[model samples]
Target: MGFDFLEWLNLAARWLHLITGIAWIGSSFYFVWLDNNLERPGSDAEAAGVSGQLWSVHGGGFYHNQKYPVGPGQLPRNLHWFKYEAYFTWLSGFSLLVLVYYVGARSFLIDPAKAALEVDDATALGITSLIVSWLFYHNACRLLARWPLALGIVWFGYLVGAAAFLESVFASRGAYLHVGAIIGTAMVGNVFFVIIPNQRKVVAAIKAGEAVDPKLGAQGKQRSVHNNYMTLPVLLIMISHHYPMTYGAQRPWLVLALLGATGIAIRHIFNVRHRNGPTGRWIALAVVLALVSVTYVSMEKSGAPAAQASVDPDAISFADVQPIIEQHCTSCHAEQPTSELFSEPPLGLKLENFEEVHAASTKVKQMAVDSDAMPLGNMTGMTDEERATLGAWIDAGDPE
Candidate 1:
């Protein structure tokens, strides 16, 4: 079957995923902001069981909103649930993951260098990991309910551990994406299993004129808080697949931890600012410094110095490097890739000749030498020795 149709389908799924994700995130942010900015209502509102109220201006109109810990004495005639957005975001994202990674497992999922995984084994691992991670997370939240500091330490430590475990099992892109998938699963699971159910129970209890469980509301809020803190880190993981420096590092797990920490710190700054707290700016400064450090560390670690000295430019020729590129790289980096996956050279890069190869010398070196991110899961049978030779050739200034 032609991948063209599949490509179009994948595009549609990804588009829907992004659109729904934005809707969900916007609602989350707005609600969090509302909660933080709300003021205790006056006697009249308090008598009506209104706990808090807020006034705002949007779209050239003044608006007022109120919150009730239980219910506003009665249910609204019309209620809008911010749920399909979360549901569809996860559904489409998982569909896209299946299409791009699971369906094309050999090309995008397994790295022989990382682990010798058959396609079935890899697919099983991916699915199992997502399920297991969510189970562990849900239980951890329950167990650590009383101590948020302990819960946070466990949560962050789990991410670090998951990063390390995944990096060992899959290719750079695959490892990063699986981590994202696990986190996304946990977020959606929070909405499905904890948040929405509690909300439904409250609504039903209010309608039935019974005492609503305060614990349900508290649990729902706790899940919401977890989702809020995870937003930035999940976003970073989602976008990490696009950047090789993040996924392609020697210690990609450490890179993941550093970046995730930076994201969390930045998120904390925003959360604090929304609450009119003073430490937000200091936290923002720390985030900036952390980002700089991450970049420096990624670069240094990704391009460890070659044990052998640089080759002599005068002694090397294009012929020495041509065979390796032609054998392993040109399949996907040429004007007409032999692989069915590409209609043209990926990233508009063509390596059909010495000139084209020389022009992209740095990129070639980065992909093959600095990191084994090329050959797309090493599908073209690229060897470490071949990568070393390509690095040496680039270091020798691409002699004709």
Candidate 2:
């Protein structure tokens, strides 16, 4: 019944981040869809500077929308800006990042097996990655403004490289989240530095009755498109920690890259469909990439079979894993967790007894056996033999 201030704060920040992120991404997607669906304006509307128009019915009402390629003949008195959603999403997301990963660095961020980083060093490296990723992406966009294909290829390569570097330095889950953070930072940066500013300039020009620069609008649209394509990948990374098969793979960076490509391919399918273009090829590509990713992760690790084969399922029992679970898992997965990192069992999964462990056998197999994702940062130093034993117990149908 006592107040857990930090936990509440984490909840608040995460909720706010989700709300604002949905708003930002929703508006971005709506506009992209609107742009793609617009038809040529009628002669009178075209004469009044309207380039395209769309008519739709929704929620028992009809709505007509028009797009002006540059600016309207006159600025509207009550123009609404969509920049705050992007800004607040980033702010709330960063706050959650600080609360969870930065404040709990030793528990969440650092993997002693990966690198021996002090809390300050880990936090600094994470922050630096965000800044440097944005700088590199922004400059790449600018330098290759005329060659979008080249820019996309280069930027994706940079992201894969960043993922590799982060995986080398942080815990796998932490590295995955940081990669997400980098993408989120760049997305909000687009809004703050390029999209909103260019939009303001357009508004100012309209107010002063000056000719609006078409290039300004073009540049903003380009960035907006980039953000739209990135939305799915960011969403996947946001929820990735809950599924260790992604970040816990032998080559997590490659897993990330393949999954990221899958997301992009799926997003491209939607984009093509919005434009009423053929989506068959993109859909095929997305399915193939997704299958490859799942198959790769499900493949046994290089040395896993030796340890797994050593444990006979017919001989292993729940009692065999009871000690392993108590020593390595119950610290964070008990009714009253002993670990300082949790005031309550994570995900409300308590393994203090055989029944509880039996009920969660699949999850245990997934987190601790299929991937060495449990023991969070390997804090209690759970061994390969211990995981193999757990796997064997599960395979034995959790024998008593």
Candidate 3:
């Protein structure tokens, strides 16, 4: 309960982590949107053959922006580098990964049923996957930067491979979170190695009054674009652990596929808009509807038995069901629950008395049986028999 030295350090780092990450992602997305929205400048020989262009005003100031598929004509002195935000975010996030998932693997990261990995193995898998993902992506980008279709095919195949990997080695929660962490790592690595170094060379060439090599600029742009596409999905996956069905379903990998695909499809619409082309609103809508449909599939599958056998009606309902709700569920689900854990009832579902409990019977069944939040099992104690009682109530129809 008390904060130790390392725990305090982690708390401080986490604050830094979120702030910097938002700055990095916000700027990146803004630029992409701006480049798509910019107008072609008059007398623009240097800006010919650009990806996209835009003009903007912010903070009582106006600015013009352009995307040169070839390198910029000149480099300005004292140019700011947008690299550290990506770097610090990755650094603090790694610290959090160690503090939360590695330290509490059984509850947060590990699933014994999925793999025989001990805590160390899971930790290694998580860390190694982060590094290797960057390697895979960077190499793939290098190999296919000139061939856009080839790059797309390779990236799509990589995602399918990642989905299969998630289903195989780690629990869905661990698997999906780790995959996002990998993407996060790749994004920062681009900032650190490829994009920054390439920018340095191109800037130096321009400063020397020499023509910048277009290839370096092209390579950097490619990596940066990949980071742009992945930003939304990584954000979604990073926070998804809090939602039960998102990362804790029977076919959780399928949910992951849909989430990633939706992120890509939405970004594709923006990319189209950026190019001064027709908006792909239909693609974005289709992606969202597809995500909803995929979620329904997981929900339908969740009600199926996670356990082997069914509970008896009379023995379970009469004796176990009502009492278990009072002891464990009511603490958090009551108007004035005596449980110190929650000050207010969650989801506004009350289970203070027999009638209130019956009225919320459906909610209780879903939360207790389908999700893991009712008794705050991860944060507190919930006996196996107590969980069984709640599960039995759901298995046996609610009969007053």
Per-residue lDDT over 1-400 for candidate 2, one digit per residue giving the tens place of the 0 to 100 score: 4578999999999999999998999999999999999999899999999989999999999999999879898877898889999999999999989999999999899999889999999999999999999999999999999998898899899999999999999999999999999999999999999999999999999999999999999999999999988899999999999888889888999999999999999989988998999999999999999999988776746544546534567888776778888899998898888898889988899999989998998999999988888888898998888887888888878899
- Highest TM-score model number: 2
Name the candidate, 1 or 2, with the larger lDDT value. Answer: 2
**Number of clashing residue pairs, candidate 1:** 0
lDDT of 3 by residue, 108-199 (tens): 67665567778898888888887777788888887877897788678767866886686587766667778778778888888888889998
Poorest lDDT segment (10 consecutive residues) of candidate 2? 302-311
The TM-scores, one per candidate, come to 0.92, 0.97, 0.78
Error of 3 at 212 (Å): 1.3
Predicted candidate 1: what Cα RMSD to the true structure? 2.5
Error of 3 at 239 (Å): 1.5
lDDT by residue for model 1 over 271-327, one digit each (tens)?
Answer: 788788897576867678587757777677656865442345457688888888889
lDDT of each: 0.84, 0.91, 0.71
Checking candidate 3 for backbone clashes, the offending pairs are 36-274, 38-53, 38-54
Off by over 4 Å in 3: 4-7, 44-53, 66-74, 280-285, 288-368, 371-400
lDDT of 2 at 172: 92
